[model samples]
Each structure stands twice: as C-alpha cells, then as structure tokens.
Target: MDLTVIWAFIIAFAVFAYVVMDGFDLGIGILFPTFAAGRERDRAMNSIAPVWDGNETWLVLGGGGLFAAFPLAYAVILPATYPLIIAMLLGLVFRGVAFEYRWRDPAHQKFWDMAFTGGSFVAALAQGMTLGALLQGIEVEGRAYAGSWWDWLTPYTLLTGLGTVAGYALLGSTWLIWKLDGEEQAHARKLAIRWGAATIVLMGAVSLYNISLNADYAARWLTAPEIYWVAPVPILTGIVAISMLRAILKERNSKPFWLGIALFFLGMSGLGVTIWPYAVPEALTIWDAAAPERSQIFMLVGVALTLPLIIGYTAWAYWVFRGKVADEGYH
Candidate 1:
C-alpha cells in the first residue's frame, strides 16, 4: 500500500477533527457579544469549558503530521500564507488567554470578553482566508513558494473568510441551543436560524467564487466524469441545511448541532473532491511533496500507538460532560 496516501488521509482526518471540535467554541466566542452579560455569558462559556482545550490536540497532530510526513508541502505552503498563519496563531493565543482569565479577573471581564470575541473572529477569518488562498492556487517555482507577501489578500479570500465566520457562528448558536436551557436556549435557536440561513448563502457564494478562481475547479465540478462523483456533495449539503433549519425552528435541542456537523462534513468532503491528490493545488502532487517512505512508516507506527489513546480520552471527556450546562457549574 502507498504510505503517502495513508499519511495524507491521517492528516486530513486530523484537520477535520480539529475543525469539528474547535469550530463551535470559536463560534461561541464570535457570538459572545450577542449573548447577555453575566449568567448568559457564563453559561455559554461553561458549555465549552470542559472540552475546548482538548479540541486543539487535533490541530497539533495535523500540523506536526504534515511537517513530519510531508515536509516539502509544509515548507512551500507556510511561506505562501505566512501572514494568515501568524494572525491565526496570535488570535488563538489571545483567545486562550481570555478563556482562562475572564472568570479569574472579574474586574477586567469586559476587556477579556472583547479579547475573546476579537481573537475568535480573527482566527476563524484567517483560517478561511488561508483556505481561499490555497484554493485559488499558490505560486510555486522550483519547490519554493514564489508568491508575493500579500498574495493571500483578495476579494475571493475575503468572501471565504466571512463565510467561515458565519458558518462558525451557526455552529456556536446550535451548540448553545443544545447546551443551555430556557431563555438562553430560545435565544440560541433564534440565532441559529439566522446564522444557518446566512451560512448556506455564503457557502454557495464561496463555492461559486472558488469555481471562478480556476477553470480546473470549474471543470472538476462541472465536467462529466468528475461531476458524477461531485454532484452528491451539494445535494447532501442542501438536504442537511433543510433538516437543520427544521430542527432549529422546531426547537429541537441536540439535532441542530449534529446536523451542523454534517454540513461541515459535507463541505470538507467537497473540498477533498476539489483538490484530491494535489498537495499544493496545480503545483505539486502528494507524492511529489511527501517525505521519505521510511519517515512516514516510522511516524505511522507512532501514530498507531498513540492515536487510539487520544481518541479514547477525548471520547471519555465528552461522555463525562454530556448534558446541559448551568451558569453556576462546570467552570
């Protein structure tokens, strides 16, 4: 079997896990200001307090796996989007700090609240823009990133960034609906309906804009053979969107969050379809950018031993913390 393909899937799984796990918390942070202060804010924060930090483990795994198993891809992609990467890291740092300090420093809670919202917004935007930059294609000349520093900043990237923000907000609102009770849950349901509609609109916009960015992308989704495989993605996405809205409007607590997750899954699957086999999108195939086979084999063994443990503990944490959150508890 090809170890490169295995490692590629492993890294993709890690990234998908990171986005699914962390996206909601960042969404909560984005919706923080809209939530009422005091008990409402505390309940929102508490809903994620138990699992938020653990969610980042997938990010570390994804990044480290790329560096170890596909060092060439890492080297090329990083320089091409350094500004977005830096902003994302800084935003994560500030968000983490605020997450920890907001409760301890009540006197400065307002400041920390702003910091949390700003950090989450910045991080989510940078992530989406980075994705847009990659989708639009990077300039690679002789195994090096050849693009200008600001190449990542474009109208398409901005749309993608905003779309991601809306997507995350939808996730956050659904999460709140699942985790809060009474007034908070009702408020969250309302937010979920609005954000859900906005997210679907923006998702469509981003997909169309992505197609416009490259004829290859257009062909991938529109041409005969490829279109046959890709056609189900949007259809499924539409189905999920309808189901999710119905759940929200009906005031079902848990279904909206799980359905939101399905939407993200379908979106990522579409992305994989769009850029499969290519590590740098029209620049380098995964094989061309992979590390030595010996290195991947070595790392696969380590991952095999440790990944189960990570999954085991993460699942256990969620199981232990299951159910609605109260303002006075869990934080």
Candidate 2:
C-alpha cells in the first residue's frame, strides 16, 4: 500500500473539514457589521458559539499531520508562505479573544465586535493568499524554500484573498438564514444572494487566473482525456450553485446551507484535480516529501483510533444544538 498517498488523503480531508466547519463562523465575522445591533448580532453570534472552537480541531489535525507525515513539504511550504501563515494565526487568535470577551465585556462590546470582523477578514484573506502562493508555485531549491519575503504579495494573491472572503461570507449568510428567523433571516437571505453571486464570479476569476499561472494547470482542466475526468467538478458546481440560489430564494432555510456546503465540496474537488499526487505543486510529489513508512504506520494507527471519536462528538454537538438559535442563547 502507498502509505504516503493514504496520509495525503487524510491531510486533505482534515483541511477540507476545517474549511467547511469554520468557514461559516469566519464568514459571520466578516458580515458582522451588516447585522443589526443587539438581538440580530447576538443571535448571529449564538448560531456558531456552540461549535466555533470545536471547528478548529480539523485545522490542528491538518497542520500536525503535515508536520508528521510530510515533514519536507511542511518545512518548505511554511517558509514559502510564512507571512500569510503568521497573519492567519494572529487573526485567529484575535478573533477568538473577541469572541470570548465581547460577551464578558459588554461595555466595550463594540470594540470586540470590530476586532472580530477585522480578524476574520484578515484570516480568510491570508488563507486564500496562501493557497494562491502555492498554486502559483513556490520557489524551492533542493527541498528548501528559496522565495523572497514578499513573493506571496501579488495581484493574483489579492484576487484569491478577496474570493475567499466572498466565499466565506456566502457560507456565513447561508448559515444565518438557517439558524435565525424573522427579520434577521430575511436579511441573511439577501446577503446570501449577494455573496453567492460574488463568490461565483470570483470563483470564475480565480479559475481563469489559476490556469494562466501555469501551462500544466490549463492542460489538466482544458486538454483532452484529463478534461473528461475533470468535467464533473465544474458541472456539479454549476448545478449546486443553481440549487443553492433556488433554496435561498425559496426560503428553504437549511437547504441553502447544505447546498452551500456542496459548493465548497465541489470547489475543493476541483482543487484536488488540479494538484493531485504533488505535495508542493510541481516541486514535490507526495512520495518525495513523505516521512518513512514506520512513522506513517504509527500515525495511521492513532488516526484510525481517534478520527471516529472526533466525528462522533462533532456530530453529537451539532445534533444537540440543532434548530433555531434562541434569543437568550446558550451563554
């Protein structure tokens, strides 16, 4: 068996889980300013309060798995995108602090709310830019990053950053539509339509820009034989996009959120199609960067034991917290 390939899938699953689970809350933070103060804002916050911290577990798993199973990829990728990584981490930290203190320090809740919005925006933008930096291909020299400090700060990266922000905002809006009712839900539906349209446009822009970054990327999606395999991703994405809009317009609450998830899943699938086997784009294949077999087998054992437990608890938590958020909230 190819342990490296197995580990790569596990890591990819973890990252995708992180993006879907945490993306909505970060999106909420991005759209916080638009929410009416007091009840509306509080309900929006409460919708995610139960699961926000728990959602980050996947991020820890993804990053840790990378360090353990693909040390060379981690080592090279980190230096190549350190600035964006640092920004993302700091944003998460500040966002967490704001989430906690906003309630505790009600007198200064405004400040905390602003902090939350800013932090979420920065984190989402940095994450998208990090993906862009990778897609554009990292500068590597014999397993080490050979890029300049500002290599990640380009127009393409900025476009991707904005796209991610828009995508997350869509997630947030759809989540709100599902979890809130009355005026807030109506407002969220409006926001969802706007953000959804923006996300689709930006998704298209990013795709077009992505192909321009490398001939291989263009060939993978547009060339014959490969195109047959790749066609389903975008085709499904269009179908889901239409379904999501219909669900939102029809006021189907939960359907929109689920369809939004489908959109993200399809987006991730497209990304996988674009960069399979390669751990660092054209620079390093999974085999080139993976750790020894014994280490992987050991890690796989632990993952097998713990992964089920993580999924069980996460599912249970969401199930327990299901239904419309209360005005009083869990806090």
Candidate 3:
C-alpha cells in the first residue's frame, strides 16, 4: 500500500475509534439532564467516569497522527477552522473539570452538572460543525487556506451540528439502558427512539445537501455507475441504524451500545469513502500533505508498537469495569 494511504487509514481509524468510544460518553452528557437528577444523574455520570478520559486519548492520537503524517494539511486546516477547534477544546475543558469536581464537592453538584452537559453539547456541536465545514469543502489555493473565517457557518454546516447532537444523544441513551436499571433505562429507551428518529432525518438531509452542493462528491458517492463497485459503507449504515433501533425497542441492554458503535463506524466509513485521498477534502491529497519518508517510516514503527498496547490496556480496563454501573461508580 502507498505510505500516504496507510497514514490516512491510521489517522482515520483513530478518529473512528474516538467518535465511537468518546462519542457515547459525550452522548451521555448530552442526554444527562432530561429528568436525570440526584442519584440517577450521578449513575449516568459514573457510567462513563471510568473510561471517558481514556476514550479521549483516541482524539489526541488522531490529531497527532495528522500533524505528524500530514503536516501541510494540519497547518492549513487548523487556521481555516481555528475558532471551532478552540470552542471545542474549551468545551472539553469544562467537561474534564466537571468529571473531577462533581465528585469532589456534592454541594456544588448542580453547577458541575450544568457544566458537563453544556460542555458535551458544545463539544459535539463544534465537532459536528467542523465535519460540516469539511464536507462543504475548504478553500485552499497554493496549499494555503484562502477562505473567509465565516465560511464554516453555512446552512448545511448548522444542520450538521444539530444532527450530531441528535446522533450523540441516541448513543448516550443506549448506553444508559446498558448501564442503569428499571426506570432510568426506560427513560433512555424513549430518548433513544426520539433521537434515533431525528438522526435518520438529519442524515438524509445532509446527504441531500451534499448532493445538491457538491456535484462531484455526489457523482462519486451515489450517482456514478462505479459507486456500486466502490463503497458499500452507506448501505451498511442503514442496517446498523435499524439494528440499534431494534435493540433499543427489545431492551437488549449491551447490544444497543455495540450497535451504536457499528452505526457510527458505518457513517464514518461512508464519509471516508467520499473523501479518501484528500487529507483536507478539496484542498490537499494525502500525497500532497505527507511528511518525508524517513518521518513516515519512524512514526509507522512507533505507531505499530503503540497501537496494540493502547488496545490491550483499553480492553483490560473495560473488562475490569464490565457489568452494570452501581452507586459507587469506580470509586
């Protein structure tokens, strides 16, 4: 395989992992309020407390990989989307602090709860907006961003922000059903159905928007004769979505979260198929943005050795913490 392609897939996998893992926890925060208070809310927080930080490591890995493997793309895209990224980070800061402080001081619990939920919503929305802007296509000329800073605020991108909020809420709802019991689980089931339905609509709207705006992307992804032979990801996405919905309706506990991961993966896979070689869609190809071969070889070695360790530790942690969350959480 081409080294550039290999690097792209590596970064893509890290991102996919982050979106699926951290995505659920983030969703939990998104769905945290709606009738969740006191012990129930604490249980919701506890369910993700064990793995949330570790899950965020995947986001770091993805960004670092891009910076290392595709410096030019990182350099350009960052400046183009600096505000959204900063806002996302700020949201993350609130979330990370809320995780620790909420446990430390029960008297001020409501403040921390607000911070957590608001942070999750902001972070999810910001990230969604980033994806939206990317799909809308960045403006790059001579390997530099040439677009207005406001370019990220298009109508399509705004809808994407809303879509992701719904999507993440659905994921969180399923997780609650898995980790909690009785009434909490039932509330989550209802939330899942509502958010799941919204997500389906928003996804359709986004696809229609994508086709309406980016003719070339649409042709490559859906309309062209070769699309049948190219990527089956979008089709698989429907199956995952249906499976998750069914799992929720059937009250299948753990199945809902796993199916949520599958749904997120299939969606990311569809996006990947649409923007393969382009590190910064419509801006730079992976080849155009890659670092020197020596850097690639060195980093590839480091990545190969480290990934298994990350995976192992992550698996071990989850195994140790398996089963329903209780009042104590991990502490």
Candidate 4:
C-alpha cells in the first residue's frame, strides 16, 4: 500500500477518535446546568473526571496529524478559522480552571460550576462554527485562505454552532444516566430525553439545509448505488435515538449513554463518508494534500510504537477512577 493511503487512514482515525472521546466530556460539561446541586451534579462531573484529560489526547493527535500529513490544509484552515480556534482554546482554559477551582472554593462553588457549563457551551459552539465553515467550503488559492473574515460569520454557520451544543448536551445527559444512581440518575434521564429530542430536530434541519445549499449532495449522498449501503446509518441512528428516549423514560441510564454515543458517532460517520476524499469538504482532495510518502512512513513507525502505549495508559487511568464518586472532598 502507498504511504499516502496509510497516512490518510491514520489521520482519519485520529480525528474520529478525538470526536468520539472528547465528545462526551464536552457533552457532560454542557449538561452541568440541569443537575443543579447535590449528588446529581457531582455524579455528572465525576462520571467524566477520570478520563477527561486522557480523552483530550485525541485532539492533540488529530491536530498533529493534520499538521504533519496535510500541511497545506492546516495552513488554510488555521488562519481562516483563527477566531473560532481562539474561542475553543479559551473555553478549554476556563473549563480546566473551573474543574479544580470550583471544588476548592466551597464558598463559591455555584459560580465555578456555571463557569464550567458556560465554557463547554463556548467550546462546543466554536467547534460547530468551524465545522459549518468547513462544510460551507473556504476560498483556497495556492493552498492559502482567500476568503473574507466575514464569510465565516454567516447564519448557517451560527446554526451549526447551536447544533453542536445540542449534540454535546445530549451526550452529557446520556452519560449521567449511565454513571449516576438514585435521584441524580433520574434527573439526568429526564434532561437527556428533552435534549435528545431537541438534538434530533436540529441535526435533521442542518442535514436538509446542507443538502439544499450544496448541489453536489446528490452526487455524494444519492448518486451511485453504493449510497444505498450508506443511507442506513442515519436511519439506524434515528431508531437508536428513539430507543434512547424510551430508555430514559423508563429510568434506564447506563445503556442509554452508550446508545447515545453510538447515535452520535453514527451521525459523524455519515458526515465523514459523505465527504470522503475531501479533507476540506469540496476544497481539496486527500491525495492532493497528503504529505510525502517518506515522511508518512516515518510517522507510521512512531504511531505503531506509541499508539498502544497511549491506549494502555488511557485504560489504566479509567480503571483507577471507575465507580460512582462518593461524598468525599474533591482532591
């Protein structure tokens, strides 16, 4: 196999890992407001506390992969989406501080918790904006950004931003159902049901809008017979989402969280498949943007050795932090 093809798969897998791992934590942060107080909110936070930092590793790997494998795409995307990137970084900072600070200052815990929620909302929004902007397609000339700054601030992009929030909130609520028990668990279930419904609506609207705007949707999604196999993912996602709603109503939290994750990942898979061969939507083909084969081969050698180590450490960390959080003071 060609090194370019191998690197392409690596990059794709890295991005997917980031989306699946950090996704739920982001969602849990977004879910902060609903639980309100006592064991419920704490349980929600505790559910992710064990692996939150490790989950973010995928982001680092994904970004690094892009910079190393598709330098041109990185150059264009970073500058064009600088504002959103800044917002995301800032949100992460606030979120990080909130996690520790909120626990330390028992006197003002509420404010810090709110800060965490707000930070999550901002980060999720920035990511969604970036995604929407990518879907809208940027102006690329000789591997550079040629579009105006205002081009990224469109209404459609804004809608995508909100969609991200809805999605994350849905993930968070589902997570709470899985890890928490008693009254907290029940509240989380309720929140999940409400937000899950809202997410389905928003996601559907975005899909319709994107299809309407992009004339190539038919070619990508509905053109050849191969698309028949692809169509079932979204259909299955809808079915699982409906089942999650029923599970929540029945006060079944654990399974709903995993199912919610499956639904979320299904949506992501649809987007990835729909935009295959194009790293930046319609802007650039993966082949055109891939790094040299020699460099990719070298990178592959490193990934082969390092990937297992990272995965092992991640599993260990989660195992150490497993089980519901007690009333013990936050360290």
Candidate 5:
C-alpha cells in the first residue's frame, strides 16, 4: 500500500478509537441524571473521572491526523460544519466546568451536574447531526459550501442525532455494568438493557432510511463483486447485537461491557469498510484530500513519538484510577 493510504488508515483508526473511547464518557455524561442518588452518581462519575480527560486526547490526535494527512478534507468539512463545531465546543466547555464546579459546592452541585449532563447531550447530538449532514454530502462548489443553515437540519440528520445519543447511552450503561457493583451494577444493567434495545431499534431505522434514500449504498455493498464480502459485515454486526441482547438478558457480571465494545467495534467496522476510499463519502477521495507527501512524512515522525507518549500517559491514568469507586466517594 502507498504511504498516503497508510496515513489515511492511521487517521481513520485514530478517529474510530476516539469514538469508541471518549464516546462512552460522553455517553456517561448524558446518562448522569438517570442514576438517581448523589452517591451513586458520584461513583458513576468517578468510574470515568480518571480517564475522561485522556479520552479527549484521541479527538485532538484524530483532528491533527486529518490536518497532516487530509488537509483539504479538514479545511472544507470544518468550515461547513462550523455551527455544529461551535455547539460541540461549547458543550465540551460546559462539561469541563460542570466537572470542576460540581465538586466544589455541595449546595449548588446539582446545577453543575445537570449542566454537565446537558452539555454532554448537546455535544453528542451536534456531532451526530454533523455526521448525518456529512453523510448527506456537502454541496461543494470547488472548495466552498453551497448550502444554507436549514440544509444542515433535515429529518435524516435529526434521526442520526438521536441514533448517536442512543449509541452513546448503550456504551455508557455498559461501562457502568463493568465498573460498578451491587445495586449500582444492577441499575447500570437495567439501563444497559433498555438502552441497548432502544439503540438497536433506532440504528436499524437509520439503516433502513439510509437504504431507502440511497439504495446505491446497499447496491454497492451487496451487489458489487468486489464488495460482496461486505455483506458479512452487517451479518457480524447482527451477531454482535444478538450477543449483546443475550448478555444483557443473562445479566452477566463481567461480559456485558466487553460485548458493548464488540458491538461498537462491529458498527465502526461496517462504516469504515463501506467508506474505505472516501474520506468525505462521495465528496472527496483520500488521495484527493491528503496533505502533501512531505508534510505527512514530516508529521509522521513527530506523531510516532507523541502518540505513544499520549497512550502511555492515558494507560497510567487508568491504572491509577483502577478498581471500583470506593464507598467514601468523590473527594
């Protein structure tokens, strides 16, 4: 494979990793209100507290990878999705502030907690909408957006927004299942069961809608000889979904979260496989979008050193925070 292709794969994997990692924390934030009591909520928060900041590092690396490997795609998509980007950034700020503020004032903590959860909800939703809009493809004339604000707010985009929320909720609930015990674990399992069911339904609907609107994707994925093997991708996704269902029903202590990871990875695989050549779907091919080769080579050397450092630090943080949140709680 070409170096450009290798770099593209690197960027895509970094993004997918971010989605799988930080994605759950965002989901946890969105589900914060569902936990009822303050102690349980605090434990839930503590479960992710150590790694949440580190999780966002992947997002930065993903964007940096895009700038280095696919500068053109980055420039165009970022500007087109500026409004949604602002919303996500504001949500990030709100979440960070809530994280800090909620711990400081026992009296006003609830407000901060709610702000964190709501901020997470907004961020996740905006990102989903941005993805949906991107899937619909930008009206790009040369290198500029040729559409209005309303174009970014369509029914399909709305469906995607909800679907992403559901996906994150599933991830969050499963994380709780893994990290908590006793009543906390039970509550998370219940949430996981409900959210998992809801996610499957919502995502199934989105898939059907995508197919109905653009049968071409199905045709490309199902009919083309070169892509005929791709059918197994969805088949595997269904198997993972079914496995999740069985795990949730059985209420396994140690396996549900792993199953959730499987589900997320399978879904991501379906997406990455289907959109292999296109960085922005039909709008821009990876080669067309890539920065200059010299730039990629230069950046790769820096990235090689930095990425491992980030990973090491993140692993250390998780290690330090390992084990269940204690009874004494967030202090």
Candidate 6:
C-alpha cells in the first residue's frame, strides 16, 4: 500500500480514538446537569478525572496528523468550517477551566457547573455540525470554500448536532452506570435508557435526512453493490444498541459501558466506509489533498515512533485509575 494511503487511515484511526476516548468523558459532562447536582455530580466528575486529559490527546493526534499529512484538505476544510471549529475550541477551553476552578472556588461551584455543562453542549454540538457539513459536502471551487460562513447550519445539520448531544449523553450515562454505585449509579441507569432511546430516534432522523440531502443516496445506500460491504453497519449497530439497552435492563454494570463504546465505534466505522478515499467527500480525494510525499513520510515515521508510547501510557493510566468511584466527589 502507498504510504499516503496508510497515513490517511492512520489519521482516521486517531480521530476515532479521540472520539472513543474523549467521547465518554464528554458524555459525562453532557449528563452533568441531571440528578447529579450534589455528591452524585462529584462522583461523576471523579469517575473521569484521572483519564479525561489523556483522552483528549487523540484530538491533538488527529488534528496534528491532518495538518502535517494533508495540509491542503486542512486549509480548505478548516477555513470553510472556521466558525464551528472556533466554537469547538472555545468550548474546550471553557470546560477545561470549569473542571479545575470548580474545585478551587467551591463557593462558585454552581457557576462552574453550568459552565461545564454549557461547554460540553457547545463543543459536542459544534463537532456534529462540522460532521454534518462535511458529510453534507463542502462547496469547493478551485479547492477553496465557496459558501457563506453559516453554510455549516442547515436543518439536517442541526438535527445531527442534537443527535450528537444525545449520543454523548448516552455514552456518559453508560459509563456512570458502570463506574458508580448506589443512587448515582441508578440515576445514570435511568438516564442511559432515556438517552439510548433518543439516540435511536436521532440516528433514524440522520439516516432519513441523508436520503434527501444526497442525490446519490438511493444509488449508494439502496442499490449499490457497495451496500453489501456496509450492510453489517446498521445490523451491528442495532445489535449494540439493543445490547446496551439489555444490559441496563438486566442491571448489569460493566457490560453497558462496553456496549455503548461498541455502538459508537460501529457508527464511526459506518461513516468511515461511506466516506473512504474522499477526505472531503465528493470533493477531494486523499491523494489530492495529501501533503508532499516527503512530509507524509516524515510524519508517518513520527507517528510510528510516538503512537506506542501513547497506547502504553493510556493503558497504564486506565489501570491505575481502575475500580468504582465513590460518591464523596473530588477532594
């Protein structure tokens, strides 16, 4: 395989890793405003505190990989989706501040709590809008953005934005159910069921909107030979979603979190299959948007050297932090 092709997939994997790692934590934040106003919230925060910073490293990996390995696509897509991207960055900043300061200024905990929840909401929403805009297809002329600033907003994209929030909440809820005990755990279980149902409906809405948004949806999804390759996506997604629901119903702890992760991975895989080879989907092929071969090779070598350390430390941290969180919150 060509090195560039390998790099493209590598970048995709990094992005997926970010979503999977940071995703549940973001979900936790999304679920913060629920029955967690007191000790429950503290327990929830403790559940993720050890691993949250580490989880976001994958975002750096993905973004840095894109800039280094596919500068052209980065230049185009970033500029086109600048507003939402900025919103995402700002939200990240906001949440990070809230995380630390809430502990420091206990008197202002309420303000910080709202900040944390609001930040997560904005970040997740912006991410979904970016995905929707990308999938909806960027208008490029001469490989440059051809649309207005708000081109990222559309009825379909907004629906996807909401879906993303629900998805993260589900992820968070399941994680809470897994890592918490007693009242906190039970509360998370209830939210998991609610968010799980919302996820299904939103996913359906996204699927339905895809048909109207894409002229080729019928050919690509309904009758294309490629459909055979992707047929397992919906089937497996349904399986995980059902399994997640089942785990919650059975009052199982650990299984629900893993099932939620499976559901997310399956959804991401489906999207990847739908948009393979085309980094910009219908506009720029990976090869076209890739950096010069020398640059790609250099970065590939760097990633190869660095990724194992990342994987190892990630494993170590999770191990060190393993076991259930107590409702005492962060001390």
Global lDDT of each candidate: 0.93, 0.94, 0.86, 0.80, 0.81, 0.86
Work out the TM-score per prediction: 0.98, 0.99, 0.96, 0.94, 0.95, 0.97
**Clashing pairs in model 1, backbone N/Cα/C closer than 3 A:** none
Q: What is the lDDT of candidate 5?
A: 0.81
lDDT of 2 by residue, 224-309 (tens): 99999899999999999999999999999799999998999999889888888788999999999999999999999999999999
Clashes of each: 0, 0, 0, 2, 0, 0
Better of 2 and 4 by TM-score: 2
Candidate 1 per-residue C-alpha lDDT over 239-294 given as tens digits, one digit per residue, 9 for 90 to 100: 99999999999989799999999999999898888888899999999999999988
- Preferred candidate (lDDT higher): 1 or 6: 1
Report how far off residue 179 is in candidate 4 (Å).
0.9
Could you tell me how far off, in angstroms, the CA of residue 60 lies in candidate 2 after the best superposition? 0.1
Better of 3 and 4 by lDDT: 3
Residue-wise lDDT of candidate 3 within 1-331, one digit each (tens)? 6888889889988998888788888898888778557778888888887899999989999999999999999988888889999999999999989989988888998999899999999999999999998888889988888999889998988998998888888888888888889788888899988998898788878877877887677887776675885556767778888888888899898898888778777777767767777888877888999999989999999999999999999998888888888878744
Worst 10 residues of 5 by lDDT: 213-222
The candidate scoring highest on lDDT is 2
Residue 160, candidate 4: alpha-carbon lDDT? 90
Regions more than 4 Å wrong, model 6: 327-329
Prediction 1 TM-score vs. true: 0.98
Clashing pairs in 3: none
Q: For model 4, which pairs clash?
A: 177-253, 178-254
- Alpha-carbon lDDT of model 3: 0.86
**Worst window of 10 by summed lDDT in candidate 2:** 322-331
Q: Tell me which of candidates 2 and 6 scores higher on lDDT.
A: 2
